[model samples]
Target: MDPWLSMYDFTYHLAQEIAEKIHERNRYLRNGENPVKINLSVRTLLKRLEESIGQLRDSLLRSVSTRQITQLEGDRRQTLIDELLTKERQLQMSFKGDGTEPDVIRSSLMSGGGAGPSPYNPWVLEEPEETRGLGIGDLKQQQQRMIREQDAGLDALSNIIARQKQMGYDIGNELDEHNEIIDDLTNLVENTDTKVRNQTRHVKLVDKKSGSCAMMVVIVLLLIAIVVVAVWPSN
Candidate 1:
C-alpha cells in the first residue's frame, strides 16, 4: 500500500483498537466499582496504540519529503499524533510499574508540560494512616488543600464533558436548519420553473392568434380590390 494510505489505515485501526480495549475493560466490570486491574490493562493497551501511532507517523514522514508533505492534509494528523505520543511518554513515566512517588510525578508533570493527573498512579487506592501532626490547625489546612485539588480536577472533567455535549447539539441544530433551507429553495425553484413554462406557452398561443388574424385581413382586402376593378371595367 501507498505510504499515505498506510498512515490513514494505521490511524483508523489505532482508534478502533483503543475503543475495543475500553469496551473490554468495561465489560469485565460490574456496577460502578472501579477495577484498578482493568484500568491498568486499558492503560497498557493505550500505551501500545500510542507507540503504533508514532511508528505510523514516522514512516509517513520518512516516505514523503518535507516539502511535499507540508501542504498535505496529513499535517493535522501528524500534529495530533505528536501530541498523543507526548501524553503517552508522560503516562509511561508516571504509571509504569516503577511505584514512583506522587510528589516526583507532580514535579515531572509540571516540568514536562503534560495535562491530567500527576504521573503517579491515582488509581492506586491506599489506606489512610494516622497523622501524628504538631497541631490541629496544620492538619485542617492540609485537608482543605487536598479538597480544593479534588474539586479542581472534578470541575475540569465536568467542563470537558459539557463542552462536548454542547458541540454535538450545535452540529445537530445546524444540520436541521440547513436541510430546511434546502427544502424551501427546492420548492421555490420548482414553482418558478413551472410559472416560466406556462408563460412561454401563453406567448406562443398569442403569436399564433395574431398571425392568423393578419393573414385573414390581407385576404379580405385583396378580394375587395378585385371586385372594384371588375365592376368599373378598368382599362
Candidate 2:
C-alpha cells in the first residue's frame, strides 16, 4: 500500500529476475548449449533491468512530489535506494560482461569454433564466405582474444551472483528480526488486556461491598429512632 513498500517490492522482483537469468545461463553452459544465445538472453535481461531502474527512480520522484514523507519513511526510502543502487551497479557490471560477449562470439566465429547454427531458427542468415580465407595464425589470435573476453564476462557474472546471494541472506535476516518484534508486541498487548480485565473486576467487587455497608447503616439508624419514640412519655 505504501509507496516505499511498493518500490521495495519492485526492486526485489527485479533483482530476483536478474539472479534467475544468471542461473539460467549457468544451466545452459552446463548443458552444452549455444553460448551465444545464452549471452544474448542475459544481455536482454540486463537491458530490461536498466529500464526498470529508470522507472523505479521516476516512481520515487513521483511519490516524493505527491506527499510529505516522514523521517521513518525517508529512512526506509533511503535504504531501498541504496539497495537498488547496489543492484544497479551489479547490472552495470553485468553490462560490462554483455559488452564483451559479442566480441567473444565474433572471435569464436573467426576461429571456426562457435556453436553451429541453431536448428530451431531456420530463417537465420549465414556468415560470408570471406571468413573461410582467414589464416591459421589469425584464427589463433582471435581464439586467444575470445578466451580473454570469455574469462572477463565469467568473472563479472560470478561477482553479480555472489552479491545477489548476500543480499538474499540480508533480507532473510531482516525478516526474522521483524517476526520476533511482532511476537513481542503481541505478548505485550495480551498482558495489558489481561491486567485491564482484572482491574475492572476488582472495581466492581469494591463497589458492591460499599453499597452493602451503606444499606446496613441506614437500617440501624431507622431502628434507633423507632425505639426512642416508643420509650418516650406523651408530652
> Which candidate number would show the highest TM-score if scored against the true structure?
2
Query: Native-vs-model 1 lDDT?
Result: 0.62
- Expressed as tens digits, the lDDT of each residue in 47-156 for candidate 1 is 67676776877766774565555546567767666655654565555544332243454344444455555544322222234423223455567678889999999999
For model 2, residues 1-235, the per-residue Cα lDDT tens digits are: 9655775676567665655555455434434465677568767766776776677667667766776666576667766676566655654454345332333333322232225633331111233454344444655676688899999999999999999999999999999999999999999999999999999999999999999999999999999999989998898
Q: Where does the lowest 10-residue lDDT sum fall in candidate 2?
A: 117-126
lDDT against the true structure, each candidate: 0.62, 0.63
Alpha carbon lDDT at 105, candidate 2: 35
> How far off is residue 229 in model 1, in Å?
2.2
Error of 2 at 7 (Å): 66
Off by over 4 Å in 1: 1-151
lDDT of 2: 0.63
RMSD of each: 21.9, 27.9
Query: Which residue pairs in candidate 2 have backbone atoms (N, alpha carbon, C) closer than 3 angstroms, thus clashing?
Result: none
lDDT over C-alpha atoms for residue 16 of model 2: 58
